[model samples]
Target: MELAKMTPLAGLVALLALAGPGAAETFTLRIGSGHAVGPVTYVNTSRDFLVPEIEKRVAERTEHKVRLIEAYGGSLAKLDETLEAVEKGILDMGHVCFCFEPSKAMVQNLNYFIPFSPPSAVQQLAITRKVYDQNPALSEHFSTNYNQTLLALSGYDNYNVGTKFEWEKFADLSGHKLGGAGPNLVWLEGSGTTVVQTGIPDYYTNIQTGVIEGNMLFPSSYFGLKLYEVAPNYKIIDMGAMMVNGLLINNDTLAKLPPEVTDIIREVAREYEQVTAEALDRDQAAGIEKLKAAGAVITVLSPEERQAWAERLAGLPGAKAKEFTEAGFDGPAIFRSYLDAAKEAGYSFPVAYAIE
Candidate 1:
């Protein structure tokens, strides 16, 4: 009899009978994320790319099977609590945005402090993955300090200035309240732009109420949030693609998994990085066109002014490096390695950061 003709129950019985003396062990992994599913978003990528690939690879390569329980869209934990949730074993795995917990995950926020490295999301992902692979200190900080294993690093397109008013020159931002989150607020310093610590959700209302004149955000977010309705001017400053978020597994949960399963998880996670990078690139292109159709004014800063903005924020990276060192991390070394990896990948910065 052909196995293909068997009923579902019959097929399961036959498979178990084929195993002879033992039944294949099954494990359940509960994965959580704060964000909801949306096209080209990280949450969507996790469902479409990471989870299915992991399940397929594990079943193919091992005697074990995994059942994934997804708890996304803040069902399990808020965005800020994701890292801690994974650390405390509330969830077996989760997506954590380092920008959300900058102090706790200071070392992981390195890319946010340094701007103007590269404009391409793929290049930025390569640079960050290289640093994480080569720099033991960075990976260790996640595993040892946070009790989580870094599965993959992913990022979005370079940020631009979304404004209610026209931004033809850098000087136009002087005395204007620019909305930014976490370390990016440092980018506006010394440029005479007063920083308003705000997040994506509040940007629209804030701009309409004149609470903030503009925000430093990427095209994907700008279009997704429909910020063009309020902030009609979009300045493509190419402030460098940022490695803002990561997927992590609880160290305790990882330790309990079979070695083959762990290996597959890590392998699939790397592919997740590539998948997300490509998605960001695609979304950015589409977003720009959408913004144009919506009648948003889009412009790119002149190369000279872009370089000048970089020069003005030159001191931020080195100062952040010092803070890293004082916090018991090799901040300067990681900073140098990040730049080196970027340079080796053919990325040239507008201003050379003073790491020494």
Candidate 2:
């Protein structure tokens, strides 16, 4: 096999062989999201970190190359339907928001039920990942039910309340109206406030039109969306960061690829969790300052009132766990594990929210 005598295809094969164990292939993958990049940190990370890092890592370490086609703002699918889109290969992969897929992705909704988690995005992600790793069912729910593989899980920054007016205690807020995403609306339970179901993208218009007077949201999303213009009262309820979004790939598409490429994709996806969380944390910290500069009034719910609120909401975790059990999951165990992880990480919740 003299160098000058080698045929072109054979030479290329030799080069690939020298580079790695598997033959090289160029893969075209389509990644998408329901929301635009600026308002959603997960969507931003999909484009900013996941896409580029996978391409870079594969090229540097393996013979495979990846070509990612990105779509956002409901181009491929809405946030709730991205799971179905990925499952059916309408989009090769997409970011799935669990808040919208409540029934289908039950286990992934654990964070919302177990509220008042530590407000740190980095710590929240760590807790979620730990629970996911320890409980295989969390990840398996995707592959078993959706025909999609979970690549990585992501979290929103510290969730808070933004309103047109301020109230000191949950009782004083009774009879007002507030809006939030599907699962989180229950977080305001028993408050005289009427909880309305609203998504982040619609919060601005909904408030402006008087459809709702306030909403629950993370600071970064609140700032990115400019909802501060309408709802200038920032209430730091610190409902905790929630692992609500997931990066997923169609199983059929993954099966067509060689291990070299799939391995790189999975590795990069794991790193995506840390990168997205850290960036969201920074954005949240900065968002608060920006909101204030723009004339948003900020308030912190007193520790006593926060504890009272948590106590009022204490039944939620246990109730949801029982509901999960009826749906054929170990609800008690799952809830307990998440609580243990948070406690182990040294988060002293406002109250001892039990599984009942």
Top candidate on lDDT is 2
Root-mean-square deviation of every model: 6.0, 3.7
lDDT of 1: 0.84
Global lDDT of each candidate: 0.84, 0.87
> For candidate 2, which ten residues in a row score worst on lDDT?
16-25
**Which tens-of-lDDT digit does each residue in 1-356 have in candidate 1?**
65646699998998878976434678799898776666226777889989998999889988888888999877988778899999999999998878778788877888888887677888888888888878877777788778998888876677888998887778889989899877778887777888888776577899999999989988887888889999899999888778788899999889888888889999999899999888887788888899999999999999989888888888878998899999998888888989899889988888888886
Q: After superposition, how far is residue 99 of candidate 2 from its true place, in Å?
A: 0.3
Mark the regions of model 1 whose C-alpha exceeds 4 Å error after superposition.
1-22
Off by more than 4 A, model 2: 1-23
**TM accuracy, model 2:** 0.92
What C-alpha lDDT, on a 0 to 100 scale, does residue 337 get in candidate 2?
A: 85
